[model samples]
Target chain A: MGVVMAVPRHVACVMDGNGRWAALRSLPRTAGHEAAEAAVMDVIEAARSSGVTWLSLYAFSTENWRRPAVEVDVLMRLVRRAIRKHAPVLHARGVRCRFLGMSDPRIPAPLVRDVADLMTLTRDNRRMTLTVAFDHGGRRDIVEAARSLIRSALPADQVTEASFAEHLPYSDTPDVDLVIRTSGEQRISNFMLWQVAYAEWIFPQVLWPDFRATHFRECLDAYRRRRRRFGDVGRTATTTGEGPR
Target chain B: MSRTTPQESADVFGPDSILRRLVGQARWALPVVRATLLEAAHPQIGAALMEHSTFLTHPWRRLRNTATSARRILDPDPRVRDREVVRLNRLHARMSGTDAQGRPYDATDRDARAWVVATLFESTVTMCRLGGEVLDADAMRRLYDEHRTFLALIDGGSDRLPATLPEFWPYYDHVVEHRLENNEAVGVILYRLLADVPAPPALRARPELWVMGRSVAGPLATAIIVASLPESFSRRVALPDLPGARTLMRSTYLAAALATRYLPESLTRVETFMGLAGAGADPWASVRRQAGKAAALVRLLTPAAEDDGETVRSADRFFAEVLDQTGDGYLRWPDLAAMAREVATRLDLGEHDEERLFQAYAAWWRELQTALDGDGDGRVTRHEYAAAAASLPGSGLIKVADVLFDVTDADDDGAIDADEYHNLFRTAFQRDLADGGGTSYSRGAFVRQFVSFMSGQQHSSAYASLLSQA
Candidate 1:
């Protein structure tokens, strides 16, 4: 009999090496971006089937804006097209779509509008949540939460970790339990810092465009084998019981 | 013989020392289990286990607790070792109960104590043998002597322990033949311990290997147990002596030891084991120190009560009420001195307990001189103290309010609200506050005191002054 695997409740993926993948193929960078769409879809399907409630895709980082203006513009356009093309499929699959990160003025107005509309349309989907982080930075998110707390006029003594967490955008999603960073990047890259304090990390060598359902499953299997101690001295979960509360 | 200094004693049990290497190796697991089973076979110990242990309900936790205690006993820190001695003493004091056959059992009984010591000696030898690290006659004698010294330190006396390794063998043989039994409780606990063995990572990665691993684990564990047992005891337990089981067990342990020698220290050394071992440069000590600092910060920020109604008492009322319990409503020097000594002892100041108590008394004396010694003659009569102490104002007891505000503010915005205070207190002091009562804080009282203290309008009352100075 196959051993039962403990799937993480939330999985965050840092899709990396698209540019490197394109360079290696002697193809335009846009091809790498285009190919990543299929990988994203495959992972989403895999995660949903594997009982992962939340999947976050690091599609665009706040630091990416500092790249060539043309690349940044093309990336923004590609993001909008991906949202428009995938929204119907995501909705049909009972997947909720949400965008995380700063709502900066630099992002084109039409793309922002489409993101909001797609989120609102799939707001009720409960099977799984697919969060696409555009222009996101973990430090920025923390700073924004602090600003929100200050603006709320809540009493200082009453503010707590839970209360401050509520101020973060998309506060309904739980902490990321497993983070898969493709392209062999070991560092977190300042993504979901507060939410992934004890999350198991898998740094797969495959580029984002080459990642598939099988690779995603392999990452899940790897995560299942991790003994997440959370700064304590034992395995966080057993094979047959709920994990540590 | 000259008295051994703490450093010299620590050197004998250091991380790289043979004793630690033997005890910490993965090959010792089977032998440790064998020892545990043997110890439980004693009727008094079995009765104690039946009464006091929760091995049936929380087997893993019970096992981990036992391992932690063992680690503490072997810890390098004199303070930690002394604390474990006290803890074991208290535990031994409580281990008295009637057996299943209506015979009264006591772990402190002469026979039971001897059996316990024998189990220890037997386990050490068995572990060395199984690990393929055979000790010669002199080495065996030295190991036994060291253990005897340890037994004396923890158990208070070694009168019941055998005088030498040669003498111990007969006692061990007699116990294995006459005293050891296949008690149902012991069997069940042994089964649980074996069943919970974590699968090797290579096997865990493959479904077929995982199943195969599970299927073989039971017999392999049983064979290890059988191999470690003496011939007569194996016959008594109905475990037929397989022709090559002993050799197989030794070879398996030897291979494991070889693998461990080649693997990275980080992978080979169990982090929990290392942390509990209290060896050189404990990482958990830093974690614990940070936790303690965080707890102190939380306590500083959290108000004593959750509502304005009962949170704040008139300074005079609080002093009078608290002092009345100390003695007769008036604070006395002798009472303060006694309180200081008690606090020092409770805090485990170790050999410096008297020094700490003296410091506490001196600090309180200084505070008293500043607040109530109006004559400046270094002594204040009761009339002089009572007259001067009435006007003393009460401030928040702990002084880290500003630092706590900065830490909890989250945004570094200068002004902190009730939410920041509540969250910081909960996160930093969850364990302490859980034991204190609940996490709720009196926002009104906290804010009032904090604001007054910050603005320099609040002063330390006599009671607050004494505690703060201490």
Candidate 2:
């Protein structure tokens, strides 16, 4: 069948299998992480070209702190270097940069400053918003949102789904429409729980380091073919409008 | 992040999340059937079916169609999933008729629509509860909100819908108390369905099968249905509280849940119904088989060739003759085997075809056994056979026409007006004949086309030509 695409406004990705990719090539995991930068660039270009307004990448999770201290250090340094190296290019391409997740002290002070600076620098860009979720947990985000709501002393009846969403870290970003996870992992792993309530999920076999613009396009095409019901019935062209009750 | 966030995390449940797993794991088939019966209890819908639906004549077909629609509603793609709701809305838009009391009925009636949504909600909750999941007030609220969101998609908006879960209860209770009726249509349909509990081959061939089966199974089926219903609704429907039966059902559900928990995800998940919607193995293969058996039974029972002195002319006559030979309603395997041999000999089967003919006979008996046997117990009782026999005479062609006309006649004026006719054509063929410019046929011409189509003559040339172009 021909691809009749309906591009989602926002696409979130769980980039997995970097360690596996490095292991497969008999290289250090750091090399795999470094290689993933190219894939990220390619995906950003693809998202911009495909009319995607928001691209949220699961770059780091709260659980990542459990890794070896050396690996964690290497990852933090890699994140800082990637931002510094690619900020100019991303800004040039009119991509707005934002950091998501908790403002924990565990995420080095200098890295946090760099993230703030980069976000400030690219705040006015219009082409796309790239949200790198470092030290993020979906559960954590919800907790923070609830805390904010409590702090504001909102009335009990005022806590609607729309209202509750506003307290999240990235309130400006819309809910995720598509969540793509690489290396064939099917589970959500607690990523963007609230945002991906109705999102279409696609799990491809390619590792994070190998995922390219072509793979991204393929995922989008696959998404286009799906019929998103939103828990409602399907309608066809011949359907007649029902009279009001 | 200081081990974890200091603030408490709220659990998020979505379509692809754990909530789907909960729904998937639950044994929903029985609850769904119970829900459908409850929905049909509503006077308007019951009356609508009595007048315009072929459900009684083609029960399995109607059920399969409903299952297909339900599967589409759960489809992953929002675009494809919403089509069934749209179709229902469009169909309902044109649906208007009179009830048994001569009161006008419209599908868009707010109360009628609300009752339908209530049935869906109650059934899902009932199923989840039966599957050993107890919802707290907050969880129930969330579920209610989710269903409201779903209803909004169907009803176009939530203006007429209740604002909160608590507010919905009284409205639902009121509907159940007053609006639902123990109408003839619902009673007859439910009785027939209950009576036709398919049994195994051993029980099916028994003499006076239906008499014995109905005696034992009929009351049991009624008790189960009663037990499944809410207490107030049960009383309204004049069904006694079957406490013992309810206990049995609970135990059965508990056992089912335990077994399902151990089973693979592929087995528990209600993916697609008959491979109609999603990519997966057809989970309803048995239902499809039953439908095929019902169709064959209808064909065989219909009067075909003229009766000869020796040769069987119709399935009804053949079965009667076999029953006479046995001197009881029960027909043992040996009796059926003998009958098969005799029929084969009468047909003068060639030596090479004899084995194949016997195999066919065996296969037919097996299919009949499967279709009649509601319980997997190898023995089929008389009631099971009677139930299968009851469905033999298919809904006649005229009844089908009546149903079609009832649906197509938007104004219920006994005639299909030009606009209604075009609407019917578009709905049936999924094409707009007037797209080229104006309707090529007049009202009379369109009526002629319908007549020709109903009579099994050549269909409308315009329709045929249009279909060919696509």
Candidate 3:
């Protein structure tokens, strides 16, 4: 059967199971982190090539600070190195780079400078936007947004869902159409608090380090196969409005 | 069985009417789920639900709301019934949306509205049949006519509905075969029904009992739902073939038949309609009082006489179904050990958690043996085990509840929030039935209500009211 495939406008990836992947290989967790840089670059390249307008990656949660200091240190170092390596290639490809939650002061000043420089360097590159959520919490984002709104002295009655959404960071990012969480875990882990109201989630069993462009394309195909209702009646035919009963 | 006269049939709420009798059955819940599924199978209705309804998220609340709406429409007072119908019509009138294919759907569409009512008539009939109430052709015709009358009362249009039972069959079959789509909504509803039925909170507190009930009733409910669907539709939907499904369906039919035939209406019928059906005496209270008197007499006759309580009978059944995994008609050490392992596995516990569960179960078993092993045979008979059930909850058995509760309290905040509680059941039994989403309260209070329900401290009606609100 011939079928038309629809491409998702915004796709997010919850890069999970790195620890498990590393443990499985009997390597230090840093090895898994190092391996994941290839998957990240592959997904970004594949998504842009596939006509996706926006892509977000969940790199670290706000709760990751609770992890042992050594693992956290390794992750911080790995992220800075990956950014330095990929910044020029990403800018050349016309991809806008963004860092979502670098509010914590523990992040090294030099690494922060490197990230800010990349963001400024790619500010005008609009072929696609890549949002990396580092030390991010979905609930905390909402709370911070609410604080911003309160600080603005906006009237309570005027705070519609749309208006409240405007106060959120990166408000231009459209609602996520597809979320791919690798390694088969189903929990949201607080990714994209305000934007994924009706996102279609695909949890593939492959670990983050092993997830490739083929798997990414497979997820896209799966997303096409799904019928997104968006809290309305499913459109089943070519028939338009028949008007009143 | 006595035949209903036309005069009695006209009054659908009359005690002897088929509508009254069928709606009164506690098994009415079966038809409600089936009817909801069938309605959602319609592409337009399913779309409207996605847009305007929370059926996907809060189905338990939706079911209770649907039941409430039905009860209001069937209220004994004409004014109340008319008012409810008007309110419903207004609510439905406001619902309009575009489908995925961009086909505009007005919820007030006559055919769609009529189909909704038709599903109720058809599903209730199927429910009655599956529940062992014989609905022959004549009875079906009578019921159909009454339903038509009901439709006219609610929608003020019976013209869109089939006029006769024979006509209804063709119309129903055509819709089932041609119009119904195995859409996303239908798939979700069916999947949740079959795979996600959670044990009630009381059962959750008792892991072994939860498994026992889950193993049987979960599959049985799913079987009845799949069996009730026409074979062509079932095949078209590509529902998985359940092993022993035929046997389960037949067993359900036979059990329902016997219950309807032998059990008093008070036991067989739903509690909501008891007073409206003009019940004379409170049968539950009367039974309780008589049981109390009998227990007193037994105590006077013999100082060593045991309670022989309802709890004990329940325990007796639990002993057989859950604790006695070997099915040797005795409770042995191996049985307790197996139960501990089963509970741990069902809960998806790690080795450390499993060991804790094992220790608790072993302690409880030793307590049972010390108190109830009359013959010193290193085994407890059903009677001896049951005799100690009255006191079992206070013994080491409570540790099991504690373990289950602790496992459920995900954050270890000493209180299981709604999500944690729901997650526990979804983790253990694939899904949960207690629509804890709508209610905001600690799990402790919910468990207490369930306990009161099981021990019969709270009246069935009271428990039902609490559950419906929950």
**Model 3 regions lying over 4 Å from their true place:** A1-245, B1-15, B197-219, B272-470
Model 2 CAPRI rating: incorrect
Error of 3 at A193 (Å): 51
Q: What is the Å distance of residue B155 in model 2 from its true position? A: 0.9
Candidate 2 — which residues are off by over 4 angstroms?
A1-245, B1-14, B17-26, B197-219, B271-470
Q: What is the C-alpha RMSD, rounded to one decimal, of candidate 3?
A: 30.3
What digit string (tens of lDDT, one per residue) describes model 2 on residues B1-470? Answer: 10111111222234543233444443665666677777788877777655544344333334444555655554556654565566556545544678768978776776666667677777777766876967888877777665555555566655455778777888778777887888866686567656643332222222244467777876776676667788887777776775599986676667667767787767665544323221123555444344433433333333333324421133333343332122233433433343333333222233334444445445545655566667866444555655565343222323333434444454666655456654533322212211111223333434445434322242243333212111
TM-score, one value per model: 0.43, 0.38, 0.38
lDDT per residue, candidate 1, B385-448, as tens digits? 5465545432321222333333435455564444553343212222110111122233343445
For candidate 3, what is the lDDT? Answer: 0.67
Task: Itemize residue pairs with steric clashes in candidate 3.
Answer: A231-B50, A231-B51, A233-B47, A234-B100, A235-B99, A235-B100, A235-B101, B196-B431
Point to the candidate with the largest TM-score: 1
- Indicate the residue-level lDDT of B117 in model 3: 79
Docking verdict class for candidate 1: incorrect
lDDT of candidate 2 vs native?
0.61
Compute DockQ for each candidate against the true complex. Answer: 0.02, 0.00, 0.00
